[model samples]
Target: MMNGNALHTLKALDPAGGSQVHASPTDRERLLANVLNTSRPAPGPAAGLLRRWRWPLAGVAVATSLAVAVSTYTLFGPNAQPAQAMTPPPLRYAPGSESPRAVLERLAVVALKDTSRVPAGSSLYLKHQGWALSTRIGQIQVTSAIVPSERETWKKADGSMRWKQRTLPPRFQNAHDEEVWSDAGAVGEDPQFTEDATGPVNANDPLNRPAPEEPRAMGKWLLASQEYAGTAEAFDSVAAHNLDELWNGRQRAAMLRFLATRTDVTYRGKVTDRAGRAGQAVSVDSAYGGLPTKYTLILDESNGKVLAYEEELTTTAGALNVKVPSVISYFCFLTARVD
Candidate 1:
């Protein structure tokens, strides 16, 4: 018998709010598979993520698209490898010789030296390879499926953008996980929610604007975007989470300059990101998504562009099935260009 709690949560996925879905044997099987393959919209501004997800949504149905949500899939081929074997080792954190403030200030200087400028009407194209954990909860079992994928986006100053993301082969920590994926029928090529569309940008996003080059203005912009309490540390969290939304070198430099003002950000030592690019790492601890997580960003050593960002659980797993100190989500940026 499914745990009453799991059954209850699965019941929440029903578009009609029907309990019969979990009671029927055929429906149960379908729901089990749906947990792995459902897809949602790409992330917008750092909305109340903790408040947003009361339940796991890996392959679950939403109220708006009942048929499509239930039928979606995150395909993975056989012969998936362990995530560690597939990617570079996690960057170790040590106290860098330079203080976080000094490093940020220095990076701001180097970043500004870059002469590359976006044309008045050109779009910013960015491509990154990364993975996020897809979780499923049962009465006695909590499973996380690591889905590695690539994303490419063309973003415009007008807040219009289009992107396509495709999942690569899924990875696991152990054989039991492979069993779960194999049982989930991972034989397809299309990953769910992989689509392309231009947009009326989320105008409310603080970073989704004319990215100011002035450090003080940039600081205010970052603060305006914070969904958390208004504090210096919260400002750090906002800067850490919104790097993907920044379009150009100067804007990022302004961001680093703003971070330099806050005394809370820590300058972690150098690291080779998952993509094998050398970067300087800095981190801030945040209670994001209601979980104790350490968010780290690795910036290209020379150019100061963001190379990767990762979120790892530090103390508690909360409702996550993953172990403490586990990386829940990570992304390695491959290319950013103006076109």
Candidate 2:
């Protein structure tokens, strides 16, 4: 939901429908200063002196008065009224015509193929089941893990990589519970294998586990393009994938079975551009089963990828607003390639 201030900012951007005009901070500051100076009264001593020098004072006073009037008009005149509400431009892509799944599948293929472009000693950002994991390649072994709160970058003789985990605090424990991997093998013992009753484990616990045989792909096969006026079939494909990924994990067969039993999928359409992309828009919503369990999917028209996904689990008995049952959100990039 957008508040008044946020709406005002959005209006000012004139996103999609209007041109982007950037004003330098220095110019803005100078303009603001001039406006302020014009609005203020002359010093008392200056005014007294000006009265003695009537002719010169009158000329100065006229100039000052004119400046003040202009400033006042600029600040409080017709232009000061709220900007007109602009209608958003129509969407660029048509629904059902584009195959979001095929696009994503291609994107995933391209991403996997391009993994070799990552320098032998460099790193890449990977998201897994709500966890932000990072992987770095080394001379002998690749290192990867769910980054700890205290550390931001890991350095070795060959190179270094920076990473920050963005999961909610309560979810970090669950991330640590899952196995962290890199391309080489498991880097360290699984954190869940160790127990800590008195205090959290020390650095010796080895945050960098061996890389998994296959790194979890992020920014792949996103729903990039869709026709807004089309049917729900394209949206349904994305929702299906999101639900499976959100719940199935490594168990594909079991996940399929779990998905088969679910029904009551719903879609709501709203015209809006995809975040961070121009000329792309979507009408998206959620499908839910019972309370606290729902899958939210967004049909992205810009790049033809599902731009966002969220799964929430809520309990009716818990705190109303504070509790988050379970969730994930996706933001895909245009440069992001699919298979």
Candidate 3:
């Protein structure tokens, strides 16, 4: 059974009701199969993970069409490789010799040096491709599905924007342990919402429109706008993403300056994002509704752009006896906005 809060938040995020479609049997099977096949664990890995960490997962589950909730997925392929052969490659950047604070402080200086300007008649175009692991009811036992997804957003200074998101079918295994593609209402390929400049702006909506160019001003506006209304950390994550999306050097510098003033923000040294891109990592930790949460941003040093956004749980509250440090959601935001 879905918790009331999660259901409510999901509805709030999907006001267009795009994910409510019923799936045909054929579609459901295909989606489940994709999820399962893409998520098989290597030999001995699951047992090792389960034994090493045990924690309860709890809290208010927030669902946005862009909600990057975290779930576990075993990485495997069609031809299973031996555990010894599955080692990850070395990180491109070595862990910073200096503290995270010093690194970010230096990066802040680099950002202030940015003189890049936006092109005329250009609009912000952002494309994000990521995966989400979410729950679904199968024929017998409930299982999780990994849905490959995409989101595209175009915006201009006038607050005119069109947002589209599509989640491809997921792969999962049914009660019979047969891999299937799940078409449960969880899968959809369409624009959830789109608006032109004339569309009404909700003062409370963080994604309502373009943001202020100055960081202090942006911070003030964010507070009043409740753009990151979920938690202080949540606010930071949203603020970081939006500032990066603006693609303005001045605004980006201001964002770093604004963040410098916050006590909760911390520099997390060098870390790689989901896309295997290496960058400096900064994170914010806070409690939302008594649940501990954290959000991390991996930033490209050359351009100071945010390479990724990551959210994870700090504690195992209501989890099914899972381990801590689990990812809740993440996105590798790629922006080449003009104008």
Top-scoring candidate (lDDT)? 1
Off by over 4 Å in 3: 1-97, 119-121, 131-143, 168-215, 227-231, 234-244, 319-322
Give per-residue CA lDDT, model 1, range 72-156, as digits (tens).
3122322332222112235676557899888888888889888777777666776777654432111101122455667677778
TM-score leader: 1
Tell me which of candidates 2 and 3 scores higher on TM-score: 3
How does model 3 score by TM-score? 0.57
Please write out the lDDT profile of model 3 over residues 1-339, one tens digit for every residue: 568589787767876567775888899999999988874321121111112112212244433211221222212222221111111122233445665556656666777678877765456776665432232112111123344445566766444566554544544435422222222233222222222223434646654435556767766654543324333643443433452256566666665666666766677777777576778877777655244667677777866666776656577434322235555445666655663
**Span of 10 residues, lowest total lDDT, candidate 3:** 80-89
Model 1: CA > 4 A from native: 1-89, 134-144, 173-180, 187-193, 202-207, 229-246
lDDT of 1 at 212: 78
Give all candidate RMSDs, comma-separated.
12.5, 28.4, 13.9
lDDT of 2: 0.28
In angstroms, give how far residue 320 of model 1 lies from its true place.
Answer: 2.1
What digit string (tens of lDDT, one per residue) describes model 2 on residues 1-339? 567589788787865657544668898899889898873321221122112222221112322332343344335543321111111122233344433334333333433332222234333332222211111111111112222111122223132223232222212133433333322143223221111111222433222221122212111111112212112222333433332122111222222222222333333333343344422223323322223334444434322234443333334312211134333122222222111
What is the alpha-carbon lDDT of model 1 when measured against the actual structure? 0.58
Better of 1 and 3 by lDDT: 1
